[model samples]
Target: MDDARQPGRAYRGRRRAQAAHTRYAAVLTTAVVGAGIVALGVSTALPEPRNDLSLEASGNFDDVSVRGGTDRAGRSRTSNPMSNMPAPDVWILPMQRYTLTSFYGERWGRLHPGVDLGAPQGTPFTAVAAGKVILCGWNGGYGNNVMIDHGDGIVTVYGHASKLLCKEGQLVKAGDRIALTGNTGHSFGAHLHFEVREHDKPIEPLAFMRKHGVDIQKHTEAIYG
Candidate 1:
């Protein structure tokens, strides 16, 4: 009986030691996991790495290329819009006597999408082509403005006017007087701010007019000279 009791006591002691070892191992694992979490937090709090490389060292980010002008394989691209317009054979001059004050393009970091023609106040300016008047009213910045849609995405804008003679939706001939020029809206002096848009994108008005057999420079020289 004494020998059996001794063996039982020894077994109980061994079980207690194993339980304590397991508890110690669990505590150590928890501590290591907490330390790893703290290390991850400290690393994440640091600032992001900076790249001090220039554009030349990296790549050209400001390169602007015309859309639809080229393809991925370095081939010329072409497009055919369903609303393409027939080229006009002739176009009436917008003003009888005026000077080319400003041109259309980048001027002082801003895109001047139209040409400015300086004419005397109350000078009647006619339509450059026959079209239906789309807009005629007191427009913001443009003041008394007029817009004529000549179909096929071809549109003309007459801005900075003192008086609008035609009404919206009115059909006008090429030489019809649409408005009287004046110092209105954002104008410095009396002038007719004209614009030609092809599918709503502004293009060089001089080139457009010249393509229609209307030499704007010659007209300017004829009047101002």
Candidate 2:
């Protein structure tokens, strides 16, 4: 009887071992399937790679107009919003209201190199075009001067400023405020000595400005009167 009972107990023991092995296999399969699902979800959620060719092609930081130019990467300028804006005006008056006290040419037997626009002390003035500031601070005769280098060998100068609002290497847009009127340097009163140069040679600012659609005299009259 004891031998028969031993066989029954042995069978029960084997059944228990088989049941445990089955549960372990099921748990392992569930874990592997869950891990695979998680990996698939992560891969699908990932974002696509970004293309920076548009920004690189626009060149300058200012708003660039898209007029059918292609970059080295073969990207269209119109692909980005920053490349679609309209181009800014070529030139603008330095000061809104001022008197044309002096003209460009010989002054006291010396070349003045610029025109003097007289305005009240501490009056604000703007940049004539979009460019980078190449010079800022005091010069011998110009006193608190600021110079901007537009592309194509063109540069604009602002002299006798009561205060400078821009620094060297700063990029400025047309009509952006850059300084205030002052009687610094060799100035007689509060005024802005404005100049435009091509290849470092000063030109007739009045005629040059007229060609750009900005008449200095007309601008001053409209604002002052």
Error of 1 at 43 (Å): 59
lDDT of 1 at 185: 69
TM-score against native, each model: 0.58, 0.59
Clashes of each: 0, 0
> Poorest 10 consecutive residues of model 2 by lDDT?
38-47
lDDT of each: 0.56, 0.56
- What is candidate 2's lDDT per residue for 47-136, written digit by digit as tens? 122232121111211211121122411331123222323323345567555789878776555566678888888888888766666567
Candidate 2 pairs with clashing backbones: none
Stretches of candidate 2 exceeding 4 Å from the true structure = 1-87, 220-225
lDDT of 1 by residue, 140-221 (tens): 5667788776655677888888888998646665556788898876667988888887765567899988776566766621
| CA lDDT, candidate 1, residue 32 | 47
Give the Cα-based TM-score of candidate 1 against the true structure.
Answer: 0.58
